[model samples]
Target chain A: EDQVTQSPEALRLQEGESSSLNCSYTVSGLRGLFWYRQDPGKGPEFLFTLYSAGEEKEKERLKATLTKKESFLHITAPKPEDSATYLCAVSNNAGNMLTFGGGTRLMVKP
Target chain B: DAGITQSPRHKVTETGTPVTLRCHQTENHRYMYWYRQDPGHGLRLIHYSYGVKDTDKGEVSDGYSVSRSKTEDFLLTLESATSSQTSVYFCAIREGQGYGPLHFGNGTRLTVT
Candidate 1:
């Protein structure tokens, strides 16, 4: 069975604080991994997609890195607006859809 | 987001009643999906459509049915609403294939009494 697990169910951070969320997975054949940001009362927004290990993508203060067994979402100098539930998902040979993690709730207090 | 819209942003219905949720997309994406978000469970897929009139069940498809009569419209129907069915449902779309990131709508909150 393919599964995704995210760590640090919830995190509180101060402005300019940096942290990294983890997403570890086990799949038959790894196709891709994705990251999303969902705010309260809204659906998730697409953030990044990592297809292979040692790959990394960044947008503004958010950066996503991937490996054979896990993925990381690093927040650098986060702001209040960056506070939201970050989701990690994986798509592998088992299915054509994404298998999502429980997600990490981040709170950046300004 | 991504030119996708879900109708009935909020709904409250009684048990055993039939309820339907609609999803509209203007991105012309070939792939559309319905998922429910709940505490501790994250997001669980209910169903998805690959194209017009082409739909399939997802991980959690029991008691749920979907239809895509048009390229831009997908409908999810709960044959008989139950208390366990109350949840925030999200609709998503993907423009390409393989590794295309899905774009989601604001979501619809459905409450079953």
Candidate 2:
């Protein structure tokens, strides 16, 4: 079965702290991996999509890197405004439906 | 933010009552999806539509029905609402086929009494 798992269910970081969230997958044929940011009561906002191992994408203070079996979202110099639940999902070559990870709840205290 | 919107952002209904949630998109994307969000579960697919009159069930599709009669609208109907079904519903759309990124709506918070 295809699956995605994220660790550090909840993290509390002070402003300017740098850390990375993990997303490990066991999907056989991965088409893409996605990252999203979701606020408390809103839907997820698209972040980055990594298609292959060694692939990397960035936006502002966030960077995502992918490997054969896992992906990492590294947040640099995070701010309080950057606090949100980060979600990871994978699209398999067999289908368009995305399987999502439970997500990491991040809190960047200023 | 994408041009996706969900109706009845907040709803409270009695158990065993029929309920429907609407998802509207202005981007005219061909792929539309419905999902429910819970505390431990990130997001679970309820149903999805590829085009007008073309829809299919998803992983957690039981007890839910969906219809897409137009390119911009998708509706999820609960035959009879249950307390377990009281969750935040979200609508998403993809701009292209295959592994394209999905844009999501703000979501609908449904409560059953």
Candidate 3:
């Protein structure tokens, strides 16, 4: 079965602290990995899509990197406003549907 | 942000009532998806439409039924609302296949009493 797991269910950090969230997957063939940021009571916002191992994408203070079996979302100097739940999903070569992780809730205290 | 809109942004209904959530897109994207968000569950796919009159179930489609009669509209219906059905529903669209990112609507908050 295809499954996605994210580590550190919740994290609390002070403003300006940097941290990394991990997303691991077990699937037959990896087509793409996606990262999204979702605020409370709102839908997720697209962040990045990594297609292959060693691929990385960055936006603002967030960077997403992918490997053969996992992906990482690194936050640099995060602020209070940057606090949100980060989600990771994977799609197989069949391009059928996305399997999502439980997501990591990040709280940045100012 | 991709011109996607979900109707009945907030709804409260009694159990056993029928409820329908609508998703409309102006981008004319061929791929449209419906998902439900819950605490600690991230987002779970409910149903998706590849094109007009073409739809399929996703990971969590047990109590959900979807219809796509036009290029821009997708509807999700709950035959009988349950307390477990109270959740935030989201709609998404992808322009094409292959590794493109999905654009999501604001979402609909549904509560069952």
Candidate 4:
């Protein structure tokens, strides 16, 4: 079974502070790793997809990087509106289903 | 944003009643998935469909059932609602196979009292 684990279940950061969220996984053969941001009472919003080790993607103030066994989502100078839960998921080469992590809730205060 | 839509944004029902959640997509996506989100569970897939009438169970599929009768509609039904089944259900769609990112609906909040 493919499994994913996220670190620091919850985080509180002040405005303009930067931080990173971690996602560790074990799979038979990783096909893709995904990052998503979900606000309260809302479904997850797609952020980026990292296909292999050394691959990275960026959008707005968020950057995602992948390694052989884990992925990291780096938030640069986060603002108050950046507060949300970040989720990580992996799809194995079998292409069956995505295994998701418990997620890391971020709270950015102004 | 994806064209996915989940009906009955918020529903409150008593235990033992049957509840059905509907997911509709405007764009013809080949993959449709049903996931439930809780406080600490994140998003767990309950079921998914590859095409019309082609469905597969996910990691957590014990209490839920899904059906895809058409290209754009997927239905998830609970035989008998239980308090444990209360969660925010999200419907997601993907245009292609592997590596394609999923687009999700806003989600439906179900409460089984």
Candidate 5:
């Protein structure tokens, strides 16, 4: 079975603080790793999809990097509005279902 | 923003009653998935549909069932509501094949008493 684990169940930071969230996974055949941001009471919003190791993708203040065994979502100088739960998920080459991590709840205090 | 919509934004029901949630997508995506989000457990898939009338079970699919009679609508039904089934249900969609990113609906909050 494919499993995903995210570290630092919860994180708190200042308005301009920069930090990174980790997502570790174990799967039979790595196909793609995904990052999503979910706000309170809303569904998860798509962030990025990393297909291969050493691949990196960025959007505004968020940068997602993937390695063979894990992925990291780096938040650069996050703002108060950036506060949300970040989710990581992975799908194997043989499966269509995504195994999701527990998620990292981030609080950016102003 | 992929035009996914989940109905019954909030629902309150009693145990032993049947409940059905609807997920509609305007983008004509080929794949639709039903997932439940709980406090401790992350998003766990309940069921998924690859095409019309094509359905499959997920990791946590014991008490749930799904149907996809149309190309744009997918439905998840619980045989009997239970307190343990209270969760935020989200529907996700993907257009083509491959391991592409999925776009999710706003979610439906279900509370079983």
Candidate 6:
């Protein structure tokens, strides 16, 4: 069974604080890993996609890194506007359907 | 935004009543998906259509049904609404497999009383 687990269900950080959210997965063959940011009362916005281990992608203050069994979303100098629920998903070799993690809710206090 | 739109952004319905949600996309994508978001369960796929009239059940498709008569339109129907079904529903579309990202609609908020 393919499963995705995100750690630190919720986190609170002051402006400019740096932290990382973890997403671990168990699957037969990893195809791709996706990251999304969802705000309150809105749909999720696409962030990055990692196809292989040791791959990394960054956008502004967010950086996503992937490994053999897990992925990490690191937030650097986060601001209040960056506060949102971060989600991670993985796809197996068989299909395009994504198995999503429960998400990590981050709150940046200014 | 991917030119995706979900009708009746907010809806309140009574339990046992049948309701339908519409997802329309102008991007002409080949894949469409329906998902429900709950407090702690994350987003669970209800159903998805790979092409016109080609739909499949997802992990949480017991109480939901989907129809895709056209490439740009996908509809989700709840045979009998229940309190447990009250949640925000999102629609997404992908151009093709391995494209990496899905364009999502703003989502519809449904409340069953």
TM-score of each: 0.97, 0.98, 0.96, 0.97, 0.98, 0.97
Q: Which stretches of candidate 3 lie over 4 Å from their true place?
A: none
Give residue A46's lDDT in candidate 1 (0 to 100).
90
Off by over 4 Å in 2: none
Residue pairs with clashing backbones, model 2: none
Error of 1 at B112 (Å): 0.4
Q: Could you give candidate 1's per-residue lDDT for residues B3-97 as a string of tens digits?
A: 99899999999999999999999878899999999998999999999999999889899999999999999999999999999999999997686
CAPRI docking class of candidate 6: medium
Candidate 1: which docking quality band? medium
Using DockQ, give the best candidate's number.
Answer: 5
**For residues B32-109, what per-residue lDDT tens digits would candidate 2 score against the true structure?**
999999889879989999999999888899899999999999999999999999999999998687788888999999
The local distance difference test score of each candidate is 0.93, 0.92, 0.90, 0.92, 0.93, 0.91
**Model 1: DockQ vs. true structure:** 0.76
Clashing pairs in 1: none
Say which docking band candidate 5 falls in: high
List model 3 lDDT by residue over B2-29, tens digit each: 8998999999999999999999999789
Q: What tens digits encode model 4's per-residue C-alpha lDDT throughout A10-109?
A: 9999999999999999998999999999998788998998999999999999999999999999999999999999999999887767789999999999
Q: State candidate 3's TM-score.
A: 0.96
Question: Could you give candidate 2's per-residue lDDT for residues A19-56 as a string of tens digits?
Answer: 99999998969989999999988899999999989999
* Every candidate's CA RMSD: 1.0, 0.9, 1.2, 1.0, 0.9, 1.0
The DockQ values of the predictions, listed in order, are 0.76, 0.78, 0.70, 0.78, 0.87, 0.70
After superposing candidate 1, which stretches have Cα over 4 Å from the reference? none
lDDT of 2 at B61: 94
Report how far off residue A45 is in candidate 4 (Å): 0.3
Minimum summed lDDT over a 10-residue window in model 1 chain A is located at A90-99
**Comparison by DockQ, 2 against 4, better one:** 2
